[model samples]
Target chain A: MSREPIRDSVADLLADSGLADDGVLAHALESLRALCPPEAPEPSGALADLLRYGSEAVGAAAPSRAAHRAAEAAAGNLSPRVAPAVPLPPRKLHRGAAISAAVIAGVGLSASGVAALGGVDYSANPPQAEVRSSAAAPAEADASVPGQASKSPDATVHQAQAFAAAASGGSVAHEQPAAPSRGASDNALAGDGAAASSHAVAPSAAVWRSERSGAARAAAAAADDALAGIGRDDAAVTASQGAPRHRADSAPSRGRHVAQEAAAVAQALVAAGAEPIKEAVALGQQVRTVAPSLAGLGSRH
Target chain B: MTDSLTDHDLVAGVLPETELFSRVYQSLAPAVLGYVGARGVEDPEALMQDVFLSVLPRIGEITGGVAGLRTFVFSVAHARVVDHYRRVERRPRSVDYDPLLDMRAVPSAEAEALVRTGQTDAHLLIGSLKPEQRDVLMLRIVGELSVDDVASVLGKTPGAVKQLQRRGLKVLREMVSEGVMAQ
Candidate 1:
């Protein structure tokens, strides 16, 4: 145990080297015991005080062993370990599936909407079609009634007498012919008998007569047939209403007026029949086209 | 009171309320309290109590028998000292040694003797060092820890701890010598 020479050698090495290398210095220093401080004597009464304080404090801070176990049980810390989690699909695959499902659902919803619009019977929904038809029917009925003068000889003769009296500047009865009237006849005849005779003859009769320009005349005739087909005589109505006998030969202005009158009458009749039919045919075509697609969708489901 | 209890026997609560636990408490608490006090902690006794209370539950996990248990207790004490300073938001200062106050108001003959012996002066000098240096010195001397154990508790490399120990002791020795010279 008397390693004095070794200690002295290490100490001289340490002093000479100025403790350059930490390992050697530490090793040399460990052998020199006096360098370390002596342990201080324990202060009196300190141990007893510490023990008493520790016993009380530890008792207060930590519950008894049984109570601690109960606490751990209550907190579920002592419960069996939980089962491992279910393995999830990879993130990219899951996301791709979600996006694909969303796209498919969107397409299906769009197709369903299109099918509902095309395939549903809109006419069966009385509130929609019936309201439209009810509103339009009265106006059409009223318009076609005056044109019916062609079907009633007496009404035609009455119109004819009125026209001749209007031409001669003699007072005569101005009646509405108990029929629906258009602007052409209404403008020409809607006046007192004396006023009708006093005023110059309406140029609407000349306008109708000027419709003799080939296809334009054919169009006028077709309009007349449509009127008659609906129980309104266009030719008789025109003649009785004093359609100009010779197209008002000198008044080129009167010819333009007649042409405008004829066009108005034709437009009113065509709108009454053709517009609804065109819509119905278009709807029928749509339903026929989409019905197969909807059936296929149903089958797939 | 045998110091030879196995780690398993201690950890299994076989020593609770036993003479062995009392013996262990008696053996370690004083040094721990002294170490805490020398750190200039506000409540050294309370901190020592806390350190022992913390050690009680985990006695079973301690390895290396009595020596390991001693290291564990001191480690708890060291942590408590650090925590005290952190909580108070100020570093521990050197205790002012008033020999007049010590001699006149001695509560007991033992306190009077302790004060007369200049141990309080030694503690004041140790406290005057930087906190890390004080920690290295205190743990080495009062906690009776090896340099490696001090490093382990303080979370420094063994080499660094040795350097701190060497420097701190050198400064403490010089301070003590100066006080003696002044006296």
Candidate 2:
């Protein structure tokens, strides 16, 4: 019932039917032969007329035939039209290399910066820190002292701190090495019990000494500035002493002059002197223990 | 088996030569005639030409090579045959008989050749079989189409085509035993 291997030609059908045994299928094929005659009937018209006419000229099923042709043509044309894709350029910079390069660059820059800096002195009279010895500090500050040490970045921070403390009337005890005094003694508060104040204030009898007040210092400076004139140009002096931000263009020379004057004033304050009026400690008699070697053990034993 | 010479060769304009198309015309025209004639068309030859005419321009669109071309050629032939029947059923000519539209107007050369062979009654005998049986027989035996190709042409399953072929053959065998077909 199933002629599975398709019989493509008459020879296949005839061979399949009578190939092995010519007995049954041969006779059957013979009997079946009467279905159509031996000779094929030819057409009256030429066969080539079919091709000669084409679909449009024939007009037989023209509309639908054209639609089918169009559809099939679309499907057929798609395969050959494809262009090969363009390849992207290969990556040159990988993630790890970039990150590592950035880290190395940062480390190199940091080392270069640290190498360019000098150490913070913090010594009592480090370079230009000796206030009283250099009487002409303000005058020589532009050419010499500023070039020496006071113009250091660390020194700027100390100056800023001193300004804040002085502006606060010594209430803001700065944590920095206080104006080179830290090297001379332990970082002690400014008020009392300083060895220099207790013993060295008067070298002989009682040379009463105190710093000149700001107004008195200003008057003395104004009087000494002209050298020959009676009344001076106060406005000119004030204008010349511009704030640091305003004087950034000529900061090095002018800034150093201001710093040296401040240092001179600070040294004057540090110079040994007796206070005619002393501030007594309000804690009447707080017991202070002295070490045995220094106290003679009078109170301890 | 599929032929290497597909419809694409025709459609692609590769087979522009008349000699090339002759290959197609030679291969299919006779088979299409038998298939169209078996369906009882008045002018199977003319209709077969029409089938090819419809196929020619669209030939490039046909895929699956010659076997696919074979299927399409037979399919168009079948539809043309159907359209012939529909036209016949729908319209009646003014005249009682139009010789051009009449199969009886002309005796075929094959029928004439078969006269000496005693197979002269071939069409008459085949005309007696069921319409479906006649289709299966003519498509398979005369057209030499495969059972699957017959199924595709007839719009039936392979099983249906096979059953029809078997039944038609059995009927023919019965006719042969009765001396109706053999004579």
For model 1, how does the per-residue alpha-carbon lDDT over A104-156 read when each residue is reduced to its tens digit? Answer: 99999999999887663433232442343334444433444444322232232
Pairs of residues clashing in candidate 2 = B11-B60
Assess each prediction's global lDDT (C-alpha) against the native.
0.47, 0.47
Best by DockQ: 2
Clashes of 1: 7
A94-160, model 2: which lDDT tens digit per residue? 7677789999999998988786564332322335444432444443333222332335323433443
Sliding window of 10 residues with minimal summed lDDT for model 2 chain A: A279-288
Q: Per-residue error at A35 for model 1, in Å?
A: 18
Error of 2 at B176 (Å): 1.0
Extract clashing residue pairs from model 1.
Answer: A145-A180, A146-A180, A205-A243, A205-A244, A207-A258, A207-A259, B11-B60
**iRMSD, all candidates:** 10.8, 7.7
Tens-digit lDDT string for candidate 2 (B1-183): 123344565556576555455567665665566567666777666676666656655566666667667767766666666666766778974667667567666668876666647534456556667998787767666565777778867778988977776666566556556765445
Every candidate's fraction of true contacts kept comes to: 0.02, 0.11
lDDT of 2: 0.47
